[model samples]
Target: MNKLRIGIFLGITAFAIGFAACSKSDSSANKPDPTENGFDKTAMLTNYADNLIIPAYTNLQTQLGVFETAVNSFMATPTFANQQALKTVFKDTYLKFEHVSVNQFGPAEAALYTNFTNTFPTDSAAIEGNITRGTYNLTANSTIGQQGFPALDYVLFSPFHLNDFSGPNAANRKKYVQDLVARLKTLTGNVLTGWQNTYRASFIGNTRSDSGSPIAFLINQFAFEMDQLKGPRIGWPFGKQSAGTMFPNNSEGFNAGISVALATENLVSLKAMFNGNGSGKGMSDYLIALKKDKLSSDVMTQFDKAINALKAVPDPYATAMSVNKTQIEAAYREIQILLTLIKTDVASATGVRITYQDTDGD
Candidate 1:
């Protein structure tokens, strides 16, 4: 990962903490309370199928096409600007990780663990080795330059880094790859746990309106954040690394790692909920109504469908790594759409009547 990404990740993490303090829960006392408004699960489900699930999934497919095309172009002729753009798309796509975790797994730790493993498997030896070794350069005697994208290393390598360009010591290199794979698994597991606890609690569980489920509010906030993060992945192909055989064009880890990282941010927010100062608790209460009317379960079910669709994205480690740019782009494109749609449904589920901003809007 580049410093820019690291910085963004860290910044987002910090912002989450601060954001938790002020708007943790909505005041339910002021609003109308939940009454049995016929709890229209059927109607909600129908609308969800038509408006939320189907549209979101379809949109994901379309975005995937665009992502593939853009990445293909950038791979053939990459530059710094394009690299940044690709990274942006990646960051945005990651928002789905949080959305999927909450809806699919609910608020349980076990559910989160399962979601992370399936969604962002941390078994890629090349990617982890690159990040570990990539922390600094041997010859450069300093960290890789600002434009030095360590994440690129995973793309170019064969499953075991076949060419052995990673280091001079073949034996050490092999050991490194093995170690890296293990480390990635450990790192991702840690990150997933942290992310789930933080974001979900602070945002989703915090708001509990009979009129509007706290779950819905949580997804909405996530979608809003995701829309903001959408540029980097698209820009990756256009980077200096994207054009050459040196970069190898594999985006499997790049995308997966990013998504997992953002998920970490959401978990952080969720953690804040235990505190009265935390956003999760505060936001949940804030959204509840004085009047107890049943919020639609149909929306939640539709949201669930979207979550399942996101979960449908094949495990990153399951597929063979592709060296060809076209193949890699195709893979990324396919996954990108699913991620985008996942965010769309999450936003819709939040049921926030306000016009939510699309953070990544052109």
Candidate 2:
């Protein structure tokens, strides 16, 4: 009878052990997956869509409307007051363009919107050809250099060509300005409407970092703009391109003498996008989510340094290029540091591949 009791007791102990093991297994199964525990991709995308991207496009559209009105007023009167007002409006619109230019995806990319609106260092010969012909196609790739804000700059501010707006060619020049502004207004309007009506939903829905994801596209565009800031806007004019030979004429806003101002605006827009301007989550928050606190801080600090350096550069950037080249180079170096941080550290931490090619070697 004692032996029988011992067998029963052993069986009970074995049952208890099995039951405990099964309980532990169930608890583990009920726990949340590590990948999904902290990250909320939907929230991030929603914030970007609702806060940063839409508002930027809206502001650009509004500014372009004002610009078009100013152009129309100037064309009607062609007086000094009207011309100055038009120039002021043009500057304002161009500054607004800087904010949205970094967003090179969706409708903007499909429309080649940047090329249509702000391609720089205007082709003087091509612009003259278009004006002389008066029958050229602004939509053609061939006219990209002749149809953007830079072309307007030529007609409005070129010292020798100031006559282009007030002399024998004035009629042709005015027509060209009117046409360019009209096209710019339409294109910008379309992009803004697209985001509001359709693309915003798709952009927010794409939360993955796959090839065509919004995050990937944003990163790619951000990188491309950084290269633009470093190379064409600053370096090319500073002579960092063209084998260390200074090309003051290549400066953006060369005719308007607002190159530094334009660069400052571009830098500010970049920083705003990076930080989301405190309105919502941005790339900085994404980096933090990836546990890249140091990288996030580093990138923000470098951007501040670059911006400060740019602010210190003298305005009338064409003049500064000749007399204060050192300051320009200083700003260029700071931007280069930022380029490395974003291209390497941020890209790696976020798993974003840098798809933009740096052709200038600066």
Candidate 3:
């Protein structure tokens, strides 16, 4: 063989060897061995301390600050001193803080104030009247006969039922804090689940085929999620008020009141759109047309088709953690098909068939 040919072959071999070495290095870089770093238990602890523990502690403190401000303001006013008014105020305030506590810390923290050791005085009408009548002259040391303002007890020593938190009392605080830490540890596992639920909702699905945009889908979904979260009615556990759902006087209620108000507004807006004077034609006319009229079998078929498509969308909570991205995409496509049909046909497309019977009519 020629010397030149032999040299070229040797050079090619060297180049191949160098390329192989580089590839191996890249592969090793890509797949670093987890065992090399061992278990990052300290890092995990640090994450909990920073992300979970610190945020939760800070949130509780902020809530307490708000609670303190509201309570102090209530005490300053005479009308708030009325027995009924005071009960409502306390109930409202307790519900507010209790909700955040429960949502963040779970039912156990929620139950911290379940049993009232000492109740805030609901029968302080005379005191409230006096305080209301003489507003600016109120003192922290002011006494109502031999007894002091029941509100003051809450302000100073944290009551058992009303103040279900880790306070200055080391023993009580330690117990609650331990329980909280335990709960937080459990919640750490479920963070991804909650994240998926919140995250997916941020991306909206296009319902309308003609003018459907991904951005629009996201915006609509975001709005819907927010609406559900801020439900006008009882979205979650807080709606059952009449069924002997009792809360202690010191329990936070202001936040609950705010939620209730928000829910109320949402409902009112929806109601106005569908049934109020804003829409001259009510549900009754639409329902009667849908039910009584001799509509084509195609209409029923379309309605059933749309209903099935909608029903196939997986339960919202099921995808709380991880869901197949393709599954979500398919669900959105089915919905968009139904939306297209609705947009195309006004009469046959709309499948709202409710009987709005008039009881007292002319």
| lDDT-best of 1 and 3 | 1
Better of 2 and 3 by TM-score: 2
State each model's CA lDDT, in order: 0.34, 0.74, 0.28
Error of 3 at 167 (Å): 32
Best by TM-score: 2
Tell me the tens digit of each residue's lDDT in model 3 across 1-362: 12222222233233223333433444333322111113222232233323433344344444444444454444344232332354444443333323222122112112222111111222234333443343322222122110212323332232232332222343333233233223333333243344234422311221111112222221222222222322211212222222423222312122222323322232232222222122243222232334523332333344344334333433321231134334433433443343333223322223211111111111
The segments of candidate 3 whose C-alpha lies over 4 angstroms from its true place after superposition are 1-45, 79-256, 260-362
Backbone atom clashes (below 3 Å) for every candidate = 61, 0, 17
RMSD of each: 14.8, 18.9, 26.5
Residue pairs of candidate 2 with colliding backbone atoms:
none
* TM-scores, all models, native as reference: 0.35, 0.87, 0.22
Highest lDDT model number: 2
lDDT of 1 at 134: 47
Model 2 CA lDDT for position 283 = 83
Q: Assess candidate 2 and give its lDDT.
A: 0.74
Output the worst ten-in-a-row residue range by lDDT, candidate 1. Answer: 139-148
Q: Model 1 over residues 259-312: C-alpha lDDT tens digits?
A: 324423333322222111221222222223222112222323333443343333
Task: Return model 1's CA RMSD, one decimal.
Answer: 14.8
